[model samples]
Target: MITKVTHGWRPGGLVAYLMGPGTVEEHVRPRVIASWDGLDEGWQPDTGPGGALDFQLGRLIGALQVPATRAGLPVSGQAPPGRGYVWHCSARLSATDRTLSDEEWAGVARRLLDGAGIATTEDLGGPRWIAVRHADDHIHVAAVLVREDTGRRFWPHHDYRGLRCTARELESELGLTPTALADRTAARRPQRAELELAARQGVEPARTELARVVREAAVAATDPGGFVDLLRGRGYLVELRRLPSGDPIGYKIARRATTPIWFGGGKLAPDLSMPKLITRWGQRGDATERLDAGVLAETRQTLERAERILRGARQGIAAENPDGIAHAVGDVVAALGARYGGALGEAASCYDGAARAPYEPVPDVGSVGSELRTLAGYLLRPRRRHRDDLDALSTVALLVALAALVQQIAQWRAEQGKRHQATAARDAQRLIRCTAEERRPRRGPPRPRYAREVAVDHSRRENAVAAIT
Candidate 1:
């Protein structure tokens, strides 16, 4: 399992993201795990058209704010009363364990919350929080940072490290496959300014682009010197750091000759560091043996086609053109299915179908692919009133699913062979950078004045259907 934690300032945004169908498909409704009153029933009421969930969320935030002001904490007057520290966590299980029941999944989530120091109010007199299960393999937990008994803020030191440790322990206890943990000791990753700049220029994020180039150069090089020279030839500024005895210790790379922003090797990834590279491939030897030229070319072409399809879908969604978005999403579903299906066929043909028998597609990819296909069906046959909401929801779901598929394909290819690793990494990075550019937080399109009325109408329709059923 893998765990990620993010700090936010608003609980409402988190709640809306989890409870609403925008990020998740309509078939997979989110399940509430915990709330302000510790109530387990009436999950549907909070999500009803009356805004009961938002109101309850407001009360919880209010409780936290009263204590914070009395404790003289830094409270911004411009922000809403409920606007404070919010920690959003996602704990994801392995794809192979997709058969786990809802009850079993919730049990795992509760245990994770307890282990991560968010289960009880004992530490700081209780903080209001909620856990919502969404998607297939993960659950999200949103918590306010202010303690109810004392208005003081709650910030856990070394929280990410603690979360990883807890995840590893849980993996063993739950008999789940263990995945890699991030190396916290490595150099910090580059900040987002360059990435945002790349977005503005209609290019891939600078960091990911540079990392991809460096990895490809490393794969093709005969030695460390060749690696540095290849990168320099490709418009990167490579600076190698060495010990007093002249042994290489680390390195920094920049996008251009004049750029002030340089990212350390370790910052790109732990394996990219000079020490790690040397340990794996040695100071002077072929980086890797080459694969068949025809096979490599075919793989690259397939990946490029997939990337283009996804990029078109992303662009359509960003422009908010519903018709164009639907067309592009359908293209993505077809392209991805063809790509994966072709690869599977090739594997089967190569070894008389035995080598491919054990190969299973990534769980997240399969789930998201199914959702996108279903979404396309809905987009083709839309209802009259819910067209706008359906468009937005399908767009968000497609974007989210596309991101996961890109990451999964990257990992899958890296495991295939050394020759395909660099190319796979580059394609994956390109897709990721493009998706990030499209989804970066910005001022959304203006809302209509009658938005509330439209929502009320939709809610009434839903309530009517519920009553009739």
Candidate 2:
């Protein structure tokens, strides 16, 4: 797992996106120093005129204290035990690489609280919530900051930028690398390249946008209501406000809605808020509930079978058995049923291609072609006497190919200095291109708003929207 810290934003957005969700349980508060002693009196919230900046700074100070405050910690005038006395700031954590199970994700939150010197408030019946979003390859988590000792309320302060470095330190403690934020690109003229292209086409958007729109429409179909239909009609979720109460609500659910929220009883919908829906559905004694349980059971069984195939392939990779390798690969591909679903075939290919290259005297640059041939012969002979297992045979072939690739690349760096420099360059280029190809978007076509047919084709155009789980 990886943690990416985004800081230096205006506090309002950061706080709303973090603490405003109203689900994060307070674990600690007054996370930093107690009070401002030597600073100007104008720094106070109720200060002199022109207090906007000062007010923000004051809010920052309070926000820093919120974690500890929620943790029931007092504002420490003097240096507190085990607490680092330095600059104050705020930060948010995003997980990368792999999706986490609910239990695994809770553990992450617990670690963050403990590592950051905020005592856990589990005893106080505090709520701990994880908001999983799919817009980016990261999970947005929010938790209330509480005081462990006094059980007091703590609010987040305004100036929270310094937490960037602090987050990195905490991430290291949890056995994760801090994902660095990419820098902004150089600014250009007001008339942008994408805009110009859209303007010239004058009808539909480029192929990319069309594909994106289709994907959104597809996933939205999963919602219980006609959420998918709504997205197709408007291209985005419709914003609406309730009168009298003035509570904010939206009509259409977003195309990609993986948010896990904790709310009152009326908000229950088996297909809407899935995690809670599942939990609630499992608790009831009804025919529908029983059917849902059976469906889940079947899904689990299918996944288990796939896992077995993948495990076998991994074993083949380790043992260097060509037939076993081929069998494993075939099993995996067959289990995927051609759709590929969320299988990491491309990543596996990288490893496989590297592993199965023809084995020359020097390692890492050639295939073990002879071994693969021997393994293939063994499998073919056995099949002649008995029923052939197509999937198993395919697995063996894939493993052999992977082993050969690995061996071929082993001595790649040996081509150093002037003599083999050109060969090295070519190898590097090939590797880069291959990796890029693996990651390229599988969906085709772009959709832009200005195209003549863009609005007409609001419905899903492809079967690309799928939930891997």
Most accurate candidate by lDDT: 1
lDDT of 1 at 306: 44
Worst 10 residues of 1 by lDDT: 348-357
Provide the TM-score for each candidate, comma-separated: 0.45, 0.21
Q: Which stretches of candidate 2 lie over 4 Å from their true place?
A: 1-22, 30-395, 403-469
Q: Model-by-model lDDT, in order?
A: 0.52, 0.32
Clashing pairs in 1: 67-151
Instruction: Report how far residue 357 has shifted in candidate 2, in Å.
Output: 20
lDDT of 2 at 81: 54
Clashes of 2: 96
The whole-model C-alpha lDDT of candidate 1 against the native structure comes to: 0.52
**Any runs in candidate 1 off by more than 4 Å, and if so which?**
23-31, 35-56, 64-84, 93-106, 117-127, 134-137, 146-154, 161-205, 215-230, 239-250, 257-261, 274-469
lDDT of 1 by residue, 179-279 (tens): 54433322234467876787787976767666655654543453578779878887788999989999888889987635457888767754567865564
